[model samples]
Target: MSSILRELGALVIDADLLAREVVAPGTPGLAALVEEFGPGVLTPDGELDRPAVASRVFGDEAARRTLEGIVHPRVYEEIQRLEAEAPPGAVVVHDIPLLAESGRADSFDAVVVVDAPLATQVERMVRDRGWSEDDARSRAAAQASREDRLAVATHVVENTGTREDLRRRVEEVWADLHAR
Candidate 1:
């Protein structure tokens, strides 16, 4: 959806990309993780071992909070920096995976949630990411409920359809945003 928005001329700042950049190798985010959870969170080549970190954090509330504390601020700072570079009158979209959980839904001009049913989400995770159904469900449980996400949505891209349908829906949403 964000890619569609980008194609429609919105300046999309991707949080997922920033999340990875913040933790790359020798950055403070990585150092903090090493300090808090030890170097086992790192790959043999000293990069973040995401699965290892996920295994340790997802089931434990405190550990997840600790991880969030280190990463969120850094990502936000980078987001601010990138957004500041947007040209005047440009449509700036923050493509975030955890907007509702981050307590920042109110921060955006409009929140566009690409929503799928839980079954769809689970199936996608299991199929696309090669995660076990249990791990997928566990990860989903770690985040805010679907209701919480929907409560804050100003626009929703219903993602329970075919690829061409998604493109058409995104185009409609893009048109709606401009129509406003």
Candidate 2:
């Protein structure tokens, strides 16, 4: 990814880092954990009982909205900062996983969807993170569907390939971006 950014005369803007930075120091992680447990589960002490929290926090829609309100602004701030810092003639690829969720598509020149089959994605997630099938499926379901992602994508990167193939495609895209 770094190589492709260099080749395109562009700088890399990591969405995850931006999101993490946007959250108030330590609060984002707490908020994220609260979100996972379904809100309000974090006692002032910070120890989590996953089952108890999931039953209470996730069951309440108001709690979910409150959680989003706290984090979204920070994420937006980081995104704006990164966009402002992009170098001249740079094809800034903001790798925002929640672009669709945020309804912020118009902010980018183009969208690049990294495509892979659900099964492959699940397998990779499980192998990499030791997540169970249910966990993998839930995570996948949380993201936009394949068709929706493809619809929004100006370029579809089929990640179900060898590293060489992926690199080749990235190079091609980088060359095109450079030409523009």
Candidate 3:
């Protein structure tokens, strides 16, 4: 969706990408995680061991909260800097995965959720990302509920079908955003 939006001339600020930056080696976010969860979460070369960290945090609420505490603020700060740097009146889209969970759904002019059912999400994660089914399911379960996401969504792009279908849905949503 973000890729499509970028092609369509929206300045899309991807929080997932920013999340990676905030926790890159030598960053304070990584330091905090190492302090809280220990050096085991780091690779031998000193980059974050993402899979190890995900395996630790996804199942445990406290661990997830700890990870968020170290990461979200840094991501937010980068997002603010990026938004400020966008062109005047540009159609900037903040592609945030945790808008509902972070209590910032109401902050956007329009919330476009690229929603898929749990089975669809799980299947794609397993097939495309090479994650085990249970791991995919568990990761999906950790996020905001489908209903909660829908409640905040001003537009919903259903991603249950093929890539072409997703592109079409995204295009329609893109049109709606332009209309607004």
Candidate 4:
């Protein structure tokens, strides 16, 4: 969705990328994370050890909230900066994975959900990303359920098919965005 939106000349702000930026080495966000999670969150070289942080927070709601408290404000600041800098009348697309989880569905003009079955998600995570099956299932379960996401979605792009099918659906979505 982000790629297609970018191709159509929208200013795309990827939340995942922004998350990384906010916590990069030497940033206040990183300092806060280290303070909260201890030095173990950093690599020996002083870079943020993302996997370590993930391991620490993944199943712990309190730890996750602590991390979010440190990171989200910074990400939001950057998003606001980019949005302000965009040309007038430009379409700004923010690819935020946790829109539903964050209760932010109303923040955007429309919500586009790229969805697949839980089994397919787990399989892709295990096969394509080398995640353990249990780890993949746990991560998926942590997010908003399919029904919850669908209820908030203004548009749904089924990702249960081939790359060509995804491309076609993206094109259709691009056209619809333009029409609106």
Per-structure clash totals for the candidates: 0, 2, 0, 0
Ten contiguous residues with the weakest lDDT in model 3? 171-180
Q: Which residue pairs in candidate 4 have backbone atoms (N, alpha carbon, C) closer than 3 angstroms, thus clashing?
A: none
* Highest-scoring model, TM-score: 1
Please report how far candidate 3 places residue 122 from its true position, in Å.
0.6
Sort all candidates by lDDT, best to worst.
1, 3, 4, 2
> What's the residue-level lDDT of 95 in candidate 3?
91
Q: Write the per-residue lDDT of candidate 3 for residues 42-64, one digit (tens) a residue.
A: 99999999999999999999999
In model 3, what lDDT does residue 87 have?
Answer: 92
How do the residues 8-90 of candidate 4 rate in per-residue lDDT, one tens digit apiece? 78789999999999989999999999888899999999989988987888899898888888888899899899999999878
The deviation in Å at residue 55 for candidate 2 is: 10
Q: How far is candidate 2 from the true structure (C-alpha RMSD, Å)?
A: 4.4
Compared with the true structure, all predictions reach lDDT values of 0.93, 0.68, 0.92, 0.88
Q: On residues 39-80, what C-alpha lDDT tens digit does candidate 1 reach at each position?
A: 899999999999999999999999999999999999999999
State residue 117's C-alpha deviation in candidate 3, in Å. Answer: 1.3
Off by over 4 Å in 4: none
Q: Give lDDT tens digits, candidate 2, residues 7-82.
A: 5567777766665555433566556656654445545555444445434434466654565576677777777787
Q: What TM-score should be assigned to candidate 4? A: 0.96
